[model samples]
Target chain A: MIEKTLKGKPAYWIWLAILGALIAIGWACYFRQYAFGLGLTGMSRDVSWGLYISQFTFLVGVAAGGLMLVLPYYIHNYKAFARITILGEFLAISALVMCLMFIMADLGQPLRGLNVIFFPTPHSMLFWDMCVLWGYLLLNVLCGWVILTAERKQVPPPKWIYIFVAISIPFAVSIHTVTAMLYCGLPGRHFWLSAIIAPRFLASAFAAGPSLILIACLVMRKYADFDAGKEAISKLTTIIMYAVIINTFFFLLEFFVGYYSEVPGHIHSLQYLFFGLEHNGEVYNNLVPFMWVATLFNFTGLGILAYMKIFKVFDYRLVGTAAVLIFLALWTDKGLGFVFAGFVPNPLEEVTEYIPTLNELGITIGVWATGFFLLTLLYKIAIGVEHEVEQ
Target chain B: MMDNKRRKFLKMAGATVLAGISAPAIVKLSSTDAVASGGGQEAAAGGHSQSAAGASSARIRLGMVVDMRVFYQDQALLDVAIEACVKAHNIPEIPDRKSEIKWIWKTGYENAFPEHSHNHRSQILEHNQFAVLCNHCDNPSCVKACPTKATFVVEKNGIVAMDFHRCIGCRFCMAACPFGARSFNWQDPRPFIKRYNPDFPTRMRGVVEKCNFCGERLALGLEPACVEACKGTGALVFGDLNDADSEIRKVLDEEFTIQRKPSAGTIPSVFYIV
Candidate 1:
């Protein structure tokens, strides 16, 4: 009882209060979406999908980061990651929740989402995607819970927990690949209809995902007594660098195919996405400049990381800046170009632009804030539990 | 003890997976075997076959023929076709917007005949108003991609039918259609029910809709609205291709014709004479 009482400082209450306020604001916005139909969104006949899908794609990549820690710790027996596996599992739970929230926000009738199960369409890639996401989430949640319970009870975790972790590594990769198949299977949309799209998504996801974990490690080290070690950080960044290199290669290959074919229909979409199409000004501007900026950030951050001497200064600031830039670039590319630009010169060869309305923007912000607030509360509860057990 | 539990768990999982994968295949194969047995019994008993009775009309091949010459200078005729369709079908007016339910629309000389280069190009430009609708292709791509049995090419009538209720709104049919004939209602269209087309059914939001070749009117011994409204001067001809003496057959025998976007390999039922 005294351990529980000692766990919460005044600062914990402050963080909790701040998070509660953000949750309130986000919930108010969610209510507004229920009042109005999907007309509140920027989606139209030309561009049926918009911001919600883009957010979902980004969050799924973040969730895939859990495997980065889990794979090394379990299969490879990297003892350094043992203490941090709980943190990774908790982060996976938060990321999966955000992914589900974004998808639900994008649906026409959020309540009818369960119909996906009642009436399963095996031909739809979405059904497979849903199964993979739910499976991965449950795998991590169960793995974390059983392990943590054993730790608190001062006993070895059930041997079956490692089996779950072993299964989850490949399951993690499958989750993001199934997500990529959602767009890659379409024949007409040249931008998304490539075989390499899933690999590219995984590459970029791994790159940005590990960078986020590295940043989280730095922060926890500073505030808490958790030191994940410099060697682990270095090793994680090296893996991230390889992912970035592959991601850059994919971007170049996509451009080469588009320009080489010189097929007006295929080339026109890339031109519209990267450089504005004839007379359509700054429609996909956020995508073109920001994507290149992302490439530059990845290269520059990797360059900084290459120097062993600079390892001493590899604190939250430098790692945080790199993570923000990489995350921002990828988020813009997937959200803006992947969703809206596919519709500019529609199948009829008519150029109709899609711009999200105010209501859509409001609801999107609410969804994001809700995700953040939920993550904060979950982290607080987790950290508090860890402290109580330690005492 | 823990190892024993793990091995047992693995065995249980393996059995579950094996059942999941093979159960469907076994069911599918056994059903086919039953059908094969049923066919053998029918053949042995000498069943009264469908082909023996009314074998001539065994396949009702539905088709349409449009004459461009009558519509060359008649805007009133085109207006009548559109208005008559709107009235007969109870199509709601979109109010300065184009709805997915358009049964008729006019195309200019350049768009209508991109390939045909006649010596009388000036004469052709002076008079050309072509109304375009669904080609109702013989080898339709739209029918191939529909996940549900929502969109299909009817074997008996040679017409395409869209079952809206069965549509999961995947919109694969829309992207597959090369002609851009399909339309998706982004928002609720039922509230825009100022005027309703009784002959043609209104569609819900999220599902796709297109010109169905006026399946209701074709059920009766009458022509489609657009075909019937073709200036009443043989601008549009409708008849069975199977009937050698039909008006479509006479037109095909007399005039040289072209189908839209022949490169697509759709083999359209609608034809145009230059």
Candidate 2:
């Protein structure tokens, strides 16, 4: 089935070529960054983490969000998701790849990253995060491949696959929970020190991951001639509605606790995000505009998604726009606002705003391209196999 | 000639890898008696809580007392203290504060202790500077966050030290520290050192480093460079906090000293006499 990638039309090859160029540029930028050290980027001592970590956080949600599809299709035995379960698993595999790449890109010594494996500290949440991410990726790869292959051969998937599938459900939840623990467990950064962080991560992930899948299904239907059935698409749209609402409510819950309680630690980080923080007689709020944009996208996406579900309207174009909006909103919330704003008024109560340099953005783009490349390749295999079974 | 040189390089690389594997054992054998424990979490626990491990009575918890009143009288003393540590550790002089390597540095009082400064204070307290360094906490969050135990609390003396080689440069320790004590080598630091202290090994481009409380100087029966340099003003005092008769303990007995961010629950060893 790997041969399917080679069998694409000129447009497909052109897309591959573009992705290849981006990956190459990213690799070169990473090498330059590795040579010059992490200073090539805009990260300072105050804001030690930047775009790489932010992207890694967002992608972790994406990887776990696939569980949205897996739980409904396998556990609840929702027959509508049968044709699309493979898509969710494969998307997870791709997202996990991007998560890893972003993490590697962020490391100052990429060569020594294996020290985590060499001397594993059980106390560190990072060690657990690494373990669960790799575990979830392996589960997805194995299950997605074996089940898809079984379908292509016109045989029922092996019975043993169900055991792995059951284990994967909790494995999905663990990846995001441990990832949240990465920030929330830290002492000084009051913004992330919340019990609700894991829940917010999951809610945002559920909405973002499925909406992305909706767009991918539409793309596949138009390009690859693979329709995943109207029943499946509409059901997924409903899932997005619930997830987006829960996610927004979670954001509001954070605001109420932080502001209503009037705790300076909690209020300052929130203030830094939604409104600019006044620090040392100067207002530092570079992320303020981005946060508002995310808010605008969030409610707009919510309104459209809500309308579609409320009126029993299932127009694919409007749904696609809503999906794209919801995807961007969550990406901004998790990827940009969550980590970026959390670092403001750092441990020393000094606000040092971080903006990623072009060099950093180049590396980030490269990682995303590589993820798409893998996703496109994996998806090509799945669709090709589907095209074969249909004939 | 090129093939011959390649083979020669490969042989040397193999030898270096072999040496790397055995270096830990050699360092343990040759290092200070406490480092023989290699800063293990179990030993650190024994040093902290006597009942937990019933560890030896020789488990000394070193601490520092910074007399901000004395230091603030002569603010230049803060720079002197910083100079002493920089000279001792060969910390690089990077102009960028964010990426600069600092073993010991000064921060404003309000920034140092946000909880303590929430209310209006005496003008002296508001304007004064505080010398901040690693607390070598009773429960060090950096040690817990470090995925490879690159930064660990020494069992013998309760000094939190960094092992640069073991640090994967993840910067998790940086995020973990509430005091902004840890600094990452954003770039190769050798070029930035004004005057290289050959006595100390310079950290590589990609690693985290911070105050070891002059662990090497302690082994040599000398006080930490900052404490020694401040002997004239008598602003910095270093002694075993566990020892009841120690000067640091006496200072705590007499003065109304406060630790930075007491609510953080790290139980910092460094105390400030406001």
Q: Which candidate is the best by TM-score?
A: 2
Candidate 1 docks with a DockQ of 0.11
lDDT to native, each model: 0.64, 0.84
lDDT of model 2 at position A210: 92
Write down the worst ten-residue block by lDDT for model 1 chain B: B39-48
**Candidate 1 lDDT over residue span A1-391, tens digit each:** 1143235556656765776676666567667656555555666555656777777887788788778788788888898776676777777777888888878776654565675686565666677888989999999889887887777676888997888888899988998998888777654556676898888888888876677677767766766555667778767767776777788789788888889987665676778777777742434443466556655765676665554325545554665566666666666666566666666555445556666776667666666666665555555555555665669
- Give the range of the ten consecutive residues with the poorest summed lDDT in model 2 chain B: B12-21
lDDT of 2 by residue, A256-330 (tens): 998999988989988998889998799988888888998998899889878887788888898888899889989
**Which pairs clash in model 1?**
B89-B197, B89-B198, B90-B196, B90-B197, B90-B198, B91-B197
Positional deviation of B266 in candidate 1, in angstroms? 7.9
The TM-score of candidate 1 is 0.75
